[model samples]
Every structure is written in structure tokens, then in C-alpha cells.
Target: MDILVTGILLGGTYALIAMGLNLQYGVARIMNLANGEILVAGGYFAFIAYTATQLSPILTIFLVAPLAFALNSLIYRVMLQPLVNRAKSRGQLESDSILATFGLSFIGVGLMLSFFGGDYFSYSFMAVPVEVLGNTYGANRVLSFVMAVLICGALYLWLNRSRAGLSIRAIGTTPASARLVGIDVKALSAFTFALGGAVTAVGGALISTYLTLDASTGVVFTLKALIIVIMGGVGDVRGTIVAALLLGILETLVATLLDPGLTLAAAYVMFLGILLFRPQGLFGKKPT
Candidate 1:
């Protein structure tokens, strides 16, 4: 029961980060390898705010989210937009963007290391424990999971019910068609990436309270999120959430029943098995 609860809460954090990656790669075709850095930056931002104000890091979400959005938007405008415009094919654009983001990741790592040094950062706030179904645990994980659900729910509603959401979906499905319909594809793309960054920041802030983090620490998370994104099918938000939950449960079970060191290996094995059997992912439609 403890493992089950922990896995669910942990999965929520993963889902939140994966959602951000989904928007960048699935919606905009930007293979942003630097996404993990953006996430960790958000944690650093929250830490700075907490240190200065002596407030709970949760309160810094509003500040960090927007900052992440702005930074990611700046990157897109200055470095990625030109590449997108010049690429002759979708494949070329994706390939070039991957390399560009890879370099950007290193830049982010360097900056973080230079300024923050190599030590792990953690907030000292204490969370009261909460009880559920005869299981009790720290409130921080519960809060993080709840927040993730709320954010994901709101995003789902926005995507399904709002005009802007429809535009985003349209662009994801058929960018050329969306452009023909008078949608400003470029502007919308920038907005989507900003939104992605903001979401990632929120997740980062939440997790910062739950785990130790450093500049280079986010790479593992980035890889995990990438796995979730691919497993859930690129750009498939709902599917990604489901995949995250399953992965989380699997990881928790493995960590408990076997050596914790094998958790990532278990996840990778699942990923490879999925790729071999269903490359389109569990919820994604088979590519034509």
C-alpha cells in the first residue's frame, strides 16, 4: 500500500514534466533536449525565492512559471525560429532542432554550474503527513500530486473546449492546414513552447521540495520524461499521463521488490519492449 501511494505521487511529478516535453516535441516538433535544464532552472528560481523570502517554495510557482516561459520563448525566437523557417523538410527541422537543443543543454549546464556550483539544493520546509487508506506519508508528495492533477485537468479542458486550444490541436495535426486557415503558426508555436516551459517549471518547483537537485541532476529526469513522451506517443498529453503512472508503479515495485539500482534498467527494458511491439505507443494511433 505504501509503495502504491508513493508510486502514484511520484508518477504525477513525472507526468507533469512529461507534459511539458510533449508540448515542445509533439505539438511544435521542437526536440528540445535542454528541457531538463529549463526544469532545473525553475527549481533554482524557487530556491532563490525561498532563500530571500523565507517562504514555502510552493509560493514561488507563479514567479518561476513565467520566468521559465520567457526564457524558453527567448530561446525559441533567437535560436530555433530561424532553423524552423529555413529547413526544407520536417525531418531536417527535427534533426537540426535536436542538435541545437543539445548544445543549448550544455550551455544551461555550464551557467548553472558556474553560478550555483555542484552542490545539491534543497528547501528546508517540512510537510505534515497525510493519511489515506491506512497509509500515512509526507504532505509534500500529496500536494505535488494534487497540483499536477489540477494542472493537467485544466490543460485538458483548455485543449478540448477553448478556441486557442483548438488552434493548437489543429497545428499539431496539420501545420500547413492550420496556416491556410489563417492561424499564425509561428506565433502559436512560440506560445506553445512558452506554455511548455511554464508547465515544466511548476513541476520542477514541486519536485524541488521533494528531492535534492543540482545543475546536472536534471539529465536523468530529462531522459525519463523523453521515455514517457515516446511511450505515450509524441504530443499525446493524456496518453503520457497514463504511461507515467504505469512507469511510476513499475519503478516503485522494482525498487521495493528488488535492488533500487535496477529501477532505471527496468524502465528501459519496458521502453525497448514497447518499441519492438508497438512503436506508435499504447494510445497513439499507428502512423500512416
Candidate 2:
């Protein structure tokens, strides 16, 4: 029963981690390999805020999310956009984005290391936990999970039910047409990447409080998110969330049943197995 609750909460956190990747790769189609770094940065940033201000992490996100978005925008503008704009090589656009994001990812991680040094820092705030059907635990973790769900739902509604969302979707499906119709793809791309970054920041703050973090700590998060993103289907927001939950629960179950060492390998094998049967993902549309 405890494992079940743990897995559910952890899965929601995983979904939070995946939201940024989904926005970047799934909706905007940017292969942002470095995005996981944003998670690291945001976590550290929240730690700093917590250490200094000693405020609740929920409040810390308000202080951090905007910074994350701004940093993400800067990263896209300075490091990534140029590659997309200047590349004349034979490689596809997505390939170039991946390479560029990889380069930037390394640079960002290195810069972070240079500045902060490698150290594990954690933050926590006990605002009191509400009993749910008799189970009692930290309210902060549960609050973080609920906030993650609400955030994802908000993002989904914005994409599916809002005008800006429609425009963004139109741009992704047919950029040339979108441009012909006067949609600013460049601006939209920046917005999309920033959106991803902002969400990652929230994820980072939540996860950092729940666990420990180092400068280069987001690698596992990145890998898990990437797997779930691919297995969920690129550009499918809903699919990403659903896949994250499924994978999170399954990973938890596997870790319990087998050795902890096999958890990653198991998830990898699961990804491969799913791909073999449904190459597009659980919610991805079949390619034409």
C-alpha cells in the first residue's frame, strides 16, 4: 500500500519532469537534449531561494519559474536558434536541433559546475499533511503532485482549448502554411521552449525537495523523460502524461519485484518492447 502511494506520487513527479520535454519535442518538434539541465538549474535555484529566504517551495516556484522561462528563452536564442537558422548541411532540422541542444546542454552543465561546484543540496517545508482516506504523509510532496497535475491540465487546456494553443498547433503541423498565414514561427518556437523550461523548473523544485540533487544530477531525469516521451509519442502532450504515469508505476513495481540495478534496464527493455509492437507510441498517430 505504501509502495502504491509512493509510485503514484513519484509518477506524477515524473509526469512533471516530462512536461517540458513533451512541449519541446512533442508539440514544437525541437529535439532539445539539454533541457534536462534546466531541471538541475531550477532545483539549485530553488535551493538557494530556500536557504536564503526560507520560504515554502510552492512560493519558491513563483520566484523561480519566470527565471527558468527567461533562461530557456536565452538558451534558445543564443545557442539553438542560430543552428536552426544557419544550418545548410544535409542533416535534417530535427537532427541539427538535437546536436545544437546537446552542445548547449554540455555548456550549461559545465557552467553550472564551474559556478556552484558539485554538491548535493536538498530543501523541505512542512506545511502539514492532510489525511486522505487515512493515509498520512508530507503535505508538501502531495501538494507538489497536485500542483503538477493542475499545471499539466492547464497546459493541455491552453493547447487544446485556447486560441494561442491553436496557433501553436497550426505552426507545428505546417510551419510553411503557418508562416504563409502570418504566424511567427520563430516567436512561437521561443515561446514553446520557454514553456518547456518553465514547467521543468516546477518539476525541478518539486523533485529537489523530495530528493537530493547535484550539479549534474538531472541525467536520470532526462533519460527517463526521453524514454517516456518517445514511448508516449513525440508532440503528443496527453500521451506524454499518460506514458509517464504508466512507466512510473511500472518502474516502481519492477524495482520492488527485481533488483534495483535492473530498474533502468527493465524500463529500457519495456520501451523496446512497446516500440516493437506500436512504433508510434501508445497515443501517437500512425505515420502516413
Candidate 3:
């Protein structure tokens, strides 16, 4: 029971972490390697706000979201758009984006190291214990889970119910067909990319409450997000949430029954299995 509850709580945040990457890669068709850096930056913003102004880290979401959106939009326009325009095919664009964002990740890391130094940062926020199902858990973790669920729920609704979201889905489904239907693929792609960054940053803010983070740790998160996105169907919100939960449960079970150090190895083993057997993802349809 304890493991189940803890895993569910952990998976909730994981869902938020992966959802942004899903949007960027699935909708915008840009495989951003710097996504983890963006998430770390959001955590930094929350840390700064909490330390300097005594502001609640939760409230920092509002500050981080718009800032991340604007910066990401600028990044897409200045750095990625040219690549997008020049690529001869989707494969070429993906290759170019991987290289470009890989460099950007290094730059982001350097800037963070310069400003914050290479030290772990964490803050005591809502550290009180809360009783749940005959067990105790940190109040912050519970709150974070609740917030993640709400945010993901809202995003799902927006994507399924709104016209703009329909267009975004159309592009993700078939970009060429979307273009034929008069969708401004470039502009919308940029928007989706910026929105993905904002979502990722917000996830960082939620996570900072419970996780100790440093400048260089973003890569770990990026890989985790990528794994979740792939394990779930790309662009499939429902699949992302389910895959995250499964991963969370798997990690929890492994850490509790085996060695905590093996949790990451377990994740990799699962990822490998998925790739070998279900490259199209658990929920993704096989290509024709």
C-alpha cells in the first residue's frame, strides 16, 4: 500500500516532466536536448524567489511560465527556425535540432554554473507530514501531486476541446496534410515549442519543492522525460500519464525490494524492452 501510494505520487510529477517533451517533439517536431536545462532554469527561478522574497514556490509558477515561454519563443525564432527552414526533410530537421540543442544545453549549463555555482540547492517548504492511507508522506509531495494532476487535466481538456488544440493535433498527426488545410505550420510549431518549454519549467517549479537539484542534473531529467515520452505514444497525453505511473511503480518496487541504486538500471531495462518490442510506444498505432 505504501509503495503504491508513493509510486503514484512520484509518477504524478513525472507526468508533468514528460508532457512538455511530448509537446515539443510530438507537435513541434523538434527534439530539444536542452529541455532538461529549461526545467532546471525553472527550478532556479523558484529557488531564487523563495530565498529572496520569501515567496511561495508554488506561486513562482506564474513568474516562471511566462518568462520561460518568452525565452523559448525567442530561442525558436533565433536559433531553431533557420534549421527548420533549411532542412530537406523531417529526418534532417530532427538531426539538425539534436545537434543545435545539444550545443544549447552546454551553453545553458555554463550560464547556470557561472551564476549559481556547482552546488545542490534545496529549500524547506511544506515539510510537514501528512497521513494518508495509514501511512505518512510529506505534505509538499501531496501538494505537488495535486498540482500536477490539475495542470495535466487542464491541458488535456484544452487539447481535446479547443480549436487551436485541434489544429495542433492535426499538425502532430500529419504536418503536410495540416499545411494543405491552411494551417500556418511554422507559427503554430513555434507556439507549441514555447508552450512546451513553459510546461517543462512549471514542472521544475513543482519538483523543486521535493527534490534537490543542481545545474548539471538537468540531463538526468531530460533522459527520463524522453524515456517516458517514447514509452507512451508521442503526442498522446493519456499514454504519457499512464506510462509515467507505470514507471513510478516500477521504480518504487525495485527500490523497496531490491537496491535503490538499481532503480535507474531498472528504468533502462524497461526502456530497452519497450524499444525492442514496441518502438511505436505502448499506445501508439503501428505505421502502415
* Per-candidate TM-score against the hidden true structure: 0.97, 0.92, 0.98
Maximum-lDDT candidate: 3
Off by over 4 Å in 2: 88-91, 127-134
lDDT of 1 by residue, 194-246 (tens): 89988988999988878789999878888888889989988778889998998
Candidate 3 lDDT, tens digit per residue, 140-235?
999999999999999999999999999999999999999999999999999999999999999999999998999999998898889999999899
> So what's the TM-score on candidate 3?
0.98
Best to worst by lDDT, what's the order?
A: 3, 1, 2
- Model 3 segments more than 4 A misplaced: none
> Which window of ten consecutive residues has the lowest lDDT sum in model 1?
123-132
Q: Count of backbone clashes for each model? A: 0, 1, 0
lDDT of 2: 0.81
Clashes of 3: 0
Question: Model 1: C-alpha RMSD to truth?
Answer: 1.2
Q: In candidate 3, which residue pairs clash?
A: none
- Positional deviation of residue 143's Cα in model 2 after best superposition, in angstroms: 1.3
Better of 1 and 3 by lDDT: 3
Arrange candidates by TM-score, highest first: which order? 3, 1, 2
